[model samples]
Target: MLSVHTSPLHQPGTGDAGGMNVYMVQLSRALAELGVEVDLFTRCRGEARPRWADLGPGIRLRHLEAGPRAPLPKEDMPALVVPFSLALLKEERRYDLVHSHYWLSGQAGRIAAVGWRVPLVHTAHTLARVKNAALADGDTPEPPSRIRGEHQVVGSADRLIANSGDEARALRELYGADAGRTEIVRPGVDLRTFVPGRGRAAARAALGLPVDAFVPLYAGRIQPLKGPDVMVRAVAELLREAPELRRRTIVPVVGGNSGAGPRGDAWELARELGVSDVLRHFPPVPPAELARWYRAADVLMVPSRSESFGLVALEAQACGTPVLASAVGGLPTAVRDGLTGMLVHGNDPVEYARWLRWFAEHPQAGAVMGRAAVGHARSMSWQTAAARTLDVYRDVLCAERSGPGMNEAGATARSCLADASLLEGREGRNSTLAALLS
Candidate 1:
């Protein structure tokens, strides 16, 4: 598996790491559990990381030097693709297939698969065209080079994975990806860690949240694309309408600055709106800790401009916390309207504020929705996702063994009935360097 830009071992909710990081780590573990030997490759950023580390019983994480030995923005990643690809080709071990996450890795996979004479399966965690269309104000547009790169990857990949049916349709419409070559795989949350333990009161006490406070939690990177400013504005709007509620409401943002943007943008907005006192900020926590934050909240706010899939929403729901998310991308599918959570159309603060008020006004309704959320999240599992992904790998390899002429024809026929999506898992401890790296 080619991760290329970000390491799966990196902590999420900072920099360019988010759901895709979680998706890769969790899915790989699940695949490993199914007896698949996996090698995950990423560019080394000189964080004192080893050249190679064991991720699990069947998974190895390898770091290759590319570009400078430090973090560079995603915009700077295209230049490193050739170097990364060259590094990947140096591997003497043989593999049956190559799978890549995100476009940069997809580009490298395009080269590596050709070198290895293996099939390439690419998952575009977010498409340039899709994100450009839904970009928030002051957010930088995805470069044309990226769009062209995506088009190239889309055309060359032996098979494409989408996090939802919506994403599959986007691939078909935006990049002319063949429907026969596309597969929809829904992402899942880690149910074992994110369950509602000890209910809301204990969670509130553990997190230092007021027991009677109406908490609306934002738990991802604080970037413009995530619409954290919109969340701040909504809180201000909610406070303006009901001054009394301000005393009992707390908006905790558990993330850090990310993407190409200034630092403290959301917090600056909060200060400007005079709602800074109502806001609390915390750096990203581990998944087990994150679940506690979810359990403490009345509703989880996911106001993203464009999300391939909102894994945070599913995680929050798994913690028995209803989500109040923007009705964009896979969020509509993630949060069932009027059931698990409410989906507001557009990024208007007034609408989000209105929903926030409703949840604050009707606590019982929110609790009932939270109860329903747990069941909704339970239906999706990483084991099921891995089983389906293994099917794709087997199918691709099987087609390859049958010869090139029949590969496309066979893959196209079988993909018609495939149903697969995204999955989450536990983060593993880093392993010692292996003899292969030495």
Candidate 2:
């Protein structure tokens, strides 16, 4: 697996790290549980680290020196793809199939796969065209060069993996991807860790939230794309439009800054709206701790302008917390409207504020939705996701073997899947390095 830009080992909710990091981490670990040897290659930045680090029983993260020995802005990643690919070629024929997460990795993976004569499996994670169309306020547009790169990847990859049916359709509609080559593989939640039934009162108290406060939590990277500003504005809108709701309402934003997500942007917006006292922000927390925040909230808010799979919503649901998300991208798939939560249309703060008010005004209804949310979450397990992904790997592998002129990479993929006995294992994990790097 190629994650050329960011390593799965990096902490999420920070610059250039979010769901994709979590997705890669969790998915790889699950694949490892299924007995698949996952050799994940990524860029080396920061302090000098080992070339390879054991992620799990069957997973290893290999750091390859590319650009600099420190993290660089994602905008500057394209120039390093070839260098990364060249570095990877030194390990020619070391593995079977090459799977890439995100476009940068796809570019690098494509070059290596062709050189090694192996098939390439690519997951866009989030497409440039898709993001550019739904860019948040003050967010920079995705460069045309990225669109060209993605177009090349879409055309060259043996298989395109989409986190949702919506994404699969976009691949066809946006990049003209072949439907036959597309795979719809949904992301999963950690049921054991994100389980429900925690005492909301104690959770709130532990998290420094008001014991009786109607908390609406927005957890994820605090960026324009994630719409942290929109969330702040909505809470303020809710309070200003209905001052009585302010009596016990509080909006807690959980996450770190990313891109132009200035550390104080959201806070300043809150202050300007004269709602700073009611709107709170915090650094990102580990999953175990985040579950408490999810359990304590009346509704988990996802105001993203666009999303590929909205993993945060699923995590919140797993904790018996209903989500109030923007009806964009895979958020509709994540939050089952009326059952798990409501999906407000457009980026209108007023629309989100309306749903927030409804949840605050009807606590019993929210609780009932939360119960249903748990059931929904439990159904989408990492075990199931892993098994499904293995099927894709196997199908691609076996198919390649059956065809003429197979390359070393194809042989590798086929050989890896040939372990019929290992296919029986259940699972999945994702993240830059944590989940994939697990």
Candidate 3:
């Protein structure tokens, strides 16, 4: 597994907690379960030498030094690719294939693939086009150049692994990637960690939340795109409609700091709206604590304007908590409308308030939904996701060795290019890389 300069396996909560971290950690473990030796290569964030640590018996984390030892934000990552690619090439001879995640990693992966003659596989967790549209005040979207670069990577990669069918459609429409080369692999959740049977009252008591009050929880980054403000308004509306509902509190348990600008403004907005007394905000808690919070919540609200895959929804469902999410991006795929949870229209406070009231009024229906949520969550597991990812790797490797018109080394090289391209872009450069690999 190749990540640009960061690995959730090594530093789980360093930056904005996104789905890619979940994907890397869980998928690598799953691959190991299938008797595959997995080595995750990522940049060292601090002043650390390139070293290897055992994540498990079969899984290892290899830190590579590239560019600065200090941490850089995701936006600044593209500039580090040339150096990272050079460092990656130096170590490329050891691996059979490299699977790259995110565009910056794909850029480095592409260079390394061509330089070292290895197979590259890529997965883009989120697309710039999708994200740019959902940007909030003070949040900067990826520039057009970066988006174009992503197009190149996708077009060039040997195989494109999309987290949802929606992303696949985007790939086809935006990057023109052939349907045959793209694989749909959903991100998985840890069922054991997020089990439904956990005691909500006990969990709430542990967190110092009032056990008698209905707790509405929103977990993840407190960014504008995530629409935490929408949640605040929704809760306010719920309280306004039924003044007695003040007994219930809405908790927005943010997973990461929202920097200095927009996040501060969001706080100000809460105060202005008069829900400051009810809104609870905090830095991301540990995974164990997060699970407890999920279990404790009467309902988990994910009002993100956009999401590649709703991992939070899955986690909440696993804890037998229903979710109220925006019906956009990969959210609808994870959240079954009226089944696991209710799906509301885009960040509309009125619609959200309606759902909140519906959940609050129909306690039996909510309980039924929670039970069904647990059952649905039980069917999807990190282990299953890992196995499927391993299958994708195996398929790429097999195709490299035995597919028509390519020798073992040549096929391997082609696969690597494909993987790298998946990280970079899906257009021109990616197509050129694919043609060269072929």
| Highest-lDDT candidate | 1
Best by TM-score: 1
Taking all chains together, the TM-score of candidate 3 against the true structure is: 0.89
lDDT of 2 at 435: 19
Tens digit of lDDT per residue, candidate 1, span 42-132? 9998878676798879999999988999888888898788778767877889888889999989888876665566788989999999999
Ranking by TM-score: 1, 2, 3
Winner on TM-score between 2 and 3 is: 2
Candidate 2: worst-modelled 10 consecutive residues by lDDT: 429-438
True lDDT of residue 432, candidate 1: 9
Q: Which 10 successive residues of model 1 have the least lDDT summed?
A: 428-437
Q: How do the residues 257-317 of candidate 3 rate in per-residue lDDT, one tens digit apiece?
A: 4432335355777788788887777667666778888888889999988888889899899
Candidates ranked by lDDT, best first? 1, 2, 3
* lDDT computed for candidate 3: 0.75
What does candidate 2 score on TM? 0.90
- Structural RMSD, model 1: 8.1
Name every residue pair that clashes in candidate 1.
184-420, 185-420, 185-421, 185-422, 186-421, 186-422, 187-422
